[model samples]
Target chain A: MKRLLLFVPSLLLAAFAFGQKAYLEDPDNFDPTQPTKILVDIKQCDCQRLLGAPEVFLWTWEPAELPASDPNNNGSWTSSNPALAMTNEGDDVWSFTFTPTDFYGVGADAVYSTGFSFLVKAKDGSGLGGGGCDEDKTENLSIKPELPEVPVLVVAGFPSNLLPQDVFTLVYDNSQEEKVSMQNLSADEVYCYASAFVDSVEYEVTPFFQVPNNAALQMQSSGDGTFTLMFIPEQFFTNVPTGSTITSMRFVVRKKVYLGTADQVDDPLLVPVGCP
Target chain B: MKITLKYFFILLMAAPLFTACVEDDTPDIGEEGSKLDGINATWRLVEVNQQDDVSFTLETRNISDFLLADGNAPQITFNSADKTYSVDAKGKLNFWGTEGSWTFDDDVAPTNITLSPTGESDILVNLTATIRPVDKFLQIEFSRDCGGTSIITYLYKYERAN
Candidate 1:
């Protein structure tokens, strides 16, 4: 009888560990004091009751407890307020944007020290599954506080997260270039050698040397030592076979005319492609 | 005397036939006002409702105050005489472009209006009512379809501005 009790608890723990996951939209720039969007994937959660709910709300009690003075927190497990509702991001993923300091009515120091602990759930979380405690809710999720830091050179534009068919822009800041040879490069002479891994096989989409037909691969100057290249992967990589999945892409920026090895700017950037 | 009585009964029966044939009062097609007449004026967006078609739930949000505060609300004008429409979005939320020509699927009681924006393909927009002037309201619903299934719908409600 004692062994049966021990086995049941262990099974529940295993299920909870493998359930839902959460990701920050901009993890590299995560700052507790600034507004940030957090995405939660509830595809594997035991919340069958929330599958097609018109709205979902965040229920949090960790990092710092919800203050009674906070207007958005209604302080009821059975009824969640609409002010804390999350935006549906399709495909069972939901996102909530909030600044830690203002959301919890707490100081930045407390937020940085404690981080976040929360769960996605329906407004009315009654009679949901897992013996009522787990119904219409995702497993407890947490995010450790990390100070925001400026990236060395490249940063993604618009949708920081990318899908294969989406139009993505890679912004290159010449001022932040770390390599001594690539620093202070002129924006007007910038070009990119683009390639993609289709179904795990590498295929060059643009030639390393400037060609008449590869003019589209040239990065456009956005002024102030910044350059950007925006293209749709499915459209830009014409060599990729149709119906084949693009797993990731690689880019190496350089001058139009390569002068030995010093003309290449920065290291090759490899970006993983996300599922549609 | 018998022949005179029989003629009186026949005349009484014929009186009912004359009443039925007295020219029906129903108006002809062109004589009645066209549906375009009600939709010819300017309209200002007041509210937007997003509906989850799969869930069959609607979430309504009033944006009239927001638009007023921003001072850039989208206003659309329809010209019934020329079958043309113009939108003054002022760089705001607008589905239709700056100018377009509109036509109804059925002129008498149109359920949809096909808007052909300048240099753009035709877009069929569903109408909530056969826009009449007395209604003082216009509601248009459109859906975003993914893989042949409509995932969500947006209902834009507008009030007659001019």
Candidate 2:
């Protein structure tokens, strides 16, 4: 009887510790200082009581230094606070979106060093029995956030990320042009051939040379070999069918009179669209 | 009796002069014709420039042809008589509404105009107007701020349609 009791608890602890996993939704563009959604999969965990629970909460203590809005409040193991509740993302997956620096009440340095340590649990923790995995809760989970690298400024999008409805601005630094034929091009000579991909269907605007409108494809000059094109994706690409979702955009800057491939500033650049 | 009669005659003559010297308190209606006359005609959008407030970067584009290609060139008519303005943007531009009331900050040498969209009196948009006496071109500039810092400025250039 004693051996069976010990084995049962050991199996429960092992299931709780190894079955749960956490990851960021948008890992490619994850920035520790920005708001990001962390998803926790508890389908494989032994937390039966939490799988169908109406509400789940996040319990974190990684940074050691807690924010003023910390839901733990030193230690509230028995009471699940509403502020710590995790959003249910269906199929036994829970999500919590927060800016690490803001949520932890710490600086970027602290977040980079400590990362995040958390676990998903039910609101009623009375069944936990003082730190023991006796109830519906995952074992301690940790995430080491990686920051994205800063670009050197060949082209940059204002606001970094964009949605279809946003007033998007694509800035081109002419000084960084590598092609010999594209160098020292005047503002009036520079134009962009742009296209928006909606539902995998490409919808291109008028070509630079064949533009029916006068200088419609020409980029605006800001002096010092810098140019910009600003427009709302949905408004600028009028041919896009109604109610279609824009997935991404592609464009290439070239001379107004395309003599050859050498007239192009660079290869076509692709920009991914993000959800609002 | 002869000396008193002479003094009273002198006083009566000076009273008329004093009354004539008094300045008229009524406002000047600009006898040379109101400044609003220059902007009263219907104007169509010709060009638009978006300038960054921080870097002073500019993006200028001729939008008149694009507007025409879309079959709707955005136009606005300013009625000086009723102090009202109407816009026919055809959903191309979002700066102005269908109709609104307008007023110049200084009626004599006005540099700025305030527009109040219909049914939205609390929301006001102030635009700097550049209108020359002989030029048919009109330029209105406005700034958009984010987090209490001016970020971008929109300059709309228009030409007299009528």
Residue A53 C-alpha lDDT in model 2:
72
Worst window of 10 by summed lDDT in candidate 2 chain B: B54-63
What is model 1's C-alpha RMSD? 23.4
Task: Count backbone overlaps in model 1.
Answer: 2
Model 2 C-alpha lDDT per residue in residues B1-162, reported as the tens digit of each score: 999999999999899899998998989655454567877889888776555443412323343443455656688898888999999987765556688899888777777878888887423344455454444877887666555554555677878988
Clashing pairs in 1: A128-A135, A129-A135
Which docking category, incorrect, acceptable, medium or high, applies to candidate 2? incorrect
lDDT of 1 by residue, B16-135 (tens): 999988988887655545688889899987776545443311323233442444655678888989999999976554567789899989888889989999999877789986687556
TM-score of each: 0.37, 0.38
Q: Give a tens-digit lDDT track for model 2, residues A1-276.
A: 999999999999878654658877777887767898988888665455566777788888876646546554334666666777899888888899988767777656566567788877776675656655676678778877675554566666664444565466777888998778888888688788888998689998985556425465688887889988877788888888999978888878877778878877666878776542
Alpha carbon lDDT of residue A63, candidate 2?
65
Q: Model 2 — TM-score against the truth?
A: 0.38
Model 1: residues >4 Å from true position, as ranges?
Answer: A1-147, A155-158, A210-213, B1-162
lDDT of each: 0.72, 0.72
Error of 1 at A191 (Å): 0.2
